[model samples]
Target: MAHANDAELYAQWLELLGWLDAEASARGLSFEKVADFPDYIYRMERPYDLPTTVMSVGVNSAGQPLMIAGVSPRHAQLKGVSLRLMGGSKHWHLHAGTRGLLEGKRPFTRERLAQLLDGAVRGQA
Candidate 1:
């Protein structure tokens, strides 16, 4: 199977972040982006004292690129939920820890963003 090139991966990553930003706005959540070299960190602030969810782009232990979401930066690195490109397709697949892929590969959507945020905020992913 073919794999996505760096350009394609970066473009998809930007699109995913944009979708999250829009969703955060619609949901009345505050969103911030911090660039960290090849990766970009995203934080979503919810109302009240709820934990702010952090997400960033990084490679897993296996060296696969993923968009990881979790309650903290460390959590995001160690045990966050991941959205990964499947083959050369312009689609992202949800992955949950060692259990691997959770859902079919698909384009980013509000529903998917919600799921990711929920998992990140709750530290379930």
Candidate 2:
């Protein structure tokens, strides 16, 4: 697929947010969209040490998540939406049709995001 334009990227971000919301709702978790940043924060309750789950849309060096790098195909191919593990610094990339952060799972839909979130909340992957 071609690299998505900023508008398209933003649309995808919104779609991902919708998925995350549905997932969080199902799990009785809290999901909030961060206006200042192209990210969402999921708050986990007690008994779980992970107080917050921050999932940020992967942005380019310009700090624009909605940008499609015109100069680097590398960035286009490798970049996508991403989420980090709670209390961990590394981020895992999420491609629409490929296996994502969770082993053997693809985040091709919003439901998958929720599934990944569930796994994350359960301390899996």
Candidate 3:
């Protein structure tokens, strides 16, 4: 079976977002932030359908990469990990919306997203 690492997953996500932003930008796509959700959620209506996080967010300019800014999924939360989707309140803080980036999002089916992340950061992507 095929395998994926966190870095690779993140790279894939980055690449995927690059493509999406291109399209959304042309269509005047907008953003919204939601409370209780870390930034990866586009819509909470589909909570059970969230993908896994590959790597923690770094830094960058807005309107560039669609970002779902939020506390790490493993972080402490009263009820557990927050599932905030895009197009809600505080979503503006994110560069790329959660759903925006997740259009093609899915947990690494083969390898772990963490490994992919290591490779990407090492310039293997």
Q: Which candidate is the best by TM-score?
A: 2
Minimum summed lDDT over a 10-residue window in model 3 is located at 76-85
Error of 2 at 107 (Å): 5.9
Question: With candidate 2 superimposed using the best TM-score fit, by how many Å does residue 117's alpha carbon deviate from the native?
Answer: 1.3
Per-prediction CA RMSD (Å): 14.5, 13.9, 15.4
lDDT of 3 by residue, 1-125 (tens): 23233334334444543433343344454333223335444445655323443323321224432334342332332211122223333221111232322312443221232333233334342
**Candidate 3 Cα outliers beyond 4 Å, as residue runs:** 31-125
C-alpha displacement of 24 in model 1, angstroms? 1.0
Residue-level lDDT for 6 in candidate 2: 37
**lDDT, each prediction:** 0.40, 0.42, 0.32
- Strongest candidate by lDDT: 2
Between prediction 2 and prediction 3, the one with superior lDDT is 2
Scanning candidate 1 in windows of ten residues, the lowest lDDT window is 71-80
For all predicted structures, in order, the TM-scores are 0.40, 0.50, 0.27
**lDDT value for candidate 3?**
0.32
Which pairs clash in the backbone of model 1? Answer: none
The residue-by-residue lDDT of candidate 1 on 1-125, one tens digit each, is: 23333334334445555666675555455555432422223333523222222245432223432234322223233222345332333334443322222344434455766775554444453
